[model samples]
Target: MRKNFAVIGLGRFGGSICRTLSDEGFEVLAIDKNEERVNAYAMIASHAAVGDTTDEAVLKSLGIRNFDHVIVAIGDDIQSSILTTLILKELGVNHITVKAQNDYHEKVLVKIGADKVVHPERDMGRRIANNMASSSVLDYLELSDEHSIVEIVANSKISGHTIIDLDIRKKYGLNIVAIKRGMDIIVSPKANEDIRANDVLIVIGTDEDIDRFERKVMQ
Candidate 1:
């Protein structure tokens, strides 16, 4: 389903989200206090305007609270970001997501009523480190603080075993979303499908569960 989005700030982080959302066919209103930045996104965003999100009057004028979702992607200026979020909450916005620079910023954003607080820089670093740590691990994405979706190389443990034989869900709590075997790709693989060493498993579950499964089944 298509949704309306509003992104505040037009720096690197905010600019990237704006472009991606626009490309994905979302109606985006890109806002920034900087005239140059606003103009830069004008050609891309459904609507672009120079406005101070920290100011309630400006936010009210733009009807920002009515958007399906609002992203507080303001950079560096933590004070403005927090103030803007507070106002958005007061105005009864349904959802608000804020970008935090550090742990402290993340805590403050959560306390100030941001529906979701994200630390993109720290999270990306974790992902890169996880991929480097294991040979079988292709990529890692944090589903939450504890859960993750991992792309892992299939090994010899259950090369021809079906899901029934593996007892995957009940025993391991891991769900295999897809499989990439050599040049072939399988989406929504069935329970009857046989696993083979060298196939990549795109599995989703808690980090601990994935590790356990990798040891008992994929090993």
Candidate 2:
């Protein structure tokens, strides 16, 4: 079944979610207090409405609780964001994801029953910093506070070595889940497979282990 999604607040964060969900063939209701913002998304979203989500009556009128998932992406207005999330929780929405402005906002949202709280800005900054920290690191994704998945270009030091010869799992406590060379990708590469310079290794491990691997091998 196609999931019904409602995104409150039609700013950059909310607008992106509405557009992406719509692009993915989901039914998205884009809501905002600003008529201009609502009208902007009318053609792009399954439905668009102009209403202040902080108003309980407005939320009920829109049948927001019936949606499978609701994203509260109110920007700048922390009060409205918190109030809307609180109202959604009380109305028994199955899932509620809120965009928090800061750590304090995240804490409050979690306390008020938000199913997930995202700090997009902080997370993006961390990803960018990690990519810049190592020349070989192509991309990074944080799985948790302690663990991450990273794509790193194989350097000359690790090139021509087989997985068993490198003993990466024992030496660095990291696992190479996949290897991408040009357009070809090898998933769960065999121990005898040889690594070539410039091969992109999709590795997963604790952040500490990944950093150590980057410093000792990638450098």
Candidate 3:
């Protein structure tokens, strides 16, 4: 099934999102104030409109609330971003996601009923830094402030052992949610499931526990 997504602000982040969503068979209405930006996405999105998203009248006219998810990806302009987010919330748009420029902006967006807030620049920076700093670690996804689900290669010691033998849940408070072996993915792997060497473990746990597991079992 496809979703109707309204993407506001056609900067790098918003543009990338709009194009990808369209490419993935989503109905995307991409909005941007700049003529050049709107023109850039005109052929890509299902609909491209040049409008000041901060204006409630324009937002209402566009029927933005009808979309399943409205992403306020306004770039650089902090005031416009907050105002647009507020308008989206006031208009009763479900699942509003706003891009936060900084901590202060995030606080404001949260207070205004943004269902989700994203710090793209900071997050991308952290991921790049993490990748640069670690060799064993491949990727990281933040589940919350304290918990994370990471994709890491299994170490030799823990490889070829069943999930029950590893005792990951009890010993480390981590869950081997799945095993990605070559092209196969065993979702919610059985307790007695055997893991092979070179298999990727999609594990979920607290940051500290994940780190410990990584150092001990998944070096």
Candidate 4:
């Protein structure tokens, strides 16, 4: 079954989520205290409303509990964010995801039963820093504080070498989960598979090990 979603606060973060979910064919209800923001999403969302979500009556009236998941993306207003999440929990909303401003805000949201908390700004900063640190790195995803999955372009130095010849797993302590070559994606490439120049390697490892591999091989 398709899940119904309600996104409270129509700032850049919440607006992006609403649009993406709607584009993916999910039913999304967009809400904001500002009438202008609500009107802007009226044609984009399944429903759009200008109402204070912190008010229990407003939430109940909107039938918020019936939605499968709720996203609280209130920007800068930590108190309103926390209050809305608390009300959603009290109303027995099945899943609640919130955008947190800082560590303290995240802790409070989690304590109040938020199913997920996202730090978009902080995460994006880390991703950008990783990309800038290595020219070969095409993209980066942080699995944890110490572990990451990065897409790295194979340079001439590592080209024409087979997985077995490179002994990447043993030498770098990293796993090449997949290889993106042109339009083809080789998942769990065989040991004899040769890596060509410009092939994107999807590698996962600890940050320390990945940095070592990038310096020694990619450089």
The reply for model 2, stretches above 4 Å from the true place, is: 123-219
lDDT of 2 by residue, 19-86 (tens): 65665456889999999999999999999999999899999999998998898889999999999999
Which pairs of residues clash in candidate 4, taking residues 3 or more apart in a chain or in different chains? Answer: none
Give TM per candidate: 0.60, 0.60, 0.60, 0.60
For model 3, residues 1-219, the per-residue Cα lDDT tens digits are 445888899887777677656654568899998999999999999999999988999998998989988888898999999999988899999788788999999999999899888888655423432332345568877777678888877778888789999898999999888889999999999998988878888989987787677656653
Candidate 3, number of clashes: 0
User: Number of clashing residue pairs in every model?
Assistant: 0, 0, 0, 0
lDDT of 1 by residue, 85-172 (tens): 9999999998888889888988988988899887767545345434323467888888786798999887777667876688788999
Best by lDDT: 4
- The per-residue C-alpha lDDT of model 3 at residue 182 equals 94
The reply for model 3, stretches above 4 Å from the true place, is 124-219
Error of 3 at 181 (Å): 9.2
Clashing pairs in 1: none
lDDT of each: 0.81, 0.86, 0.81, 0.87
* lDDT ranking of the models: 4, 2, 1, 3
Which portions of model 1 show Cα errors greater than 4 Å? Answer: 123-219
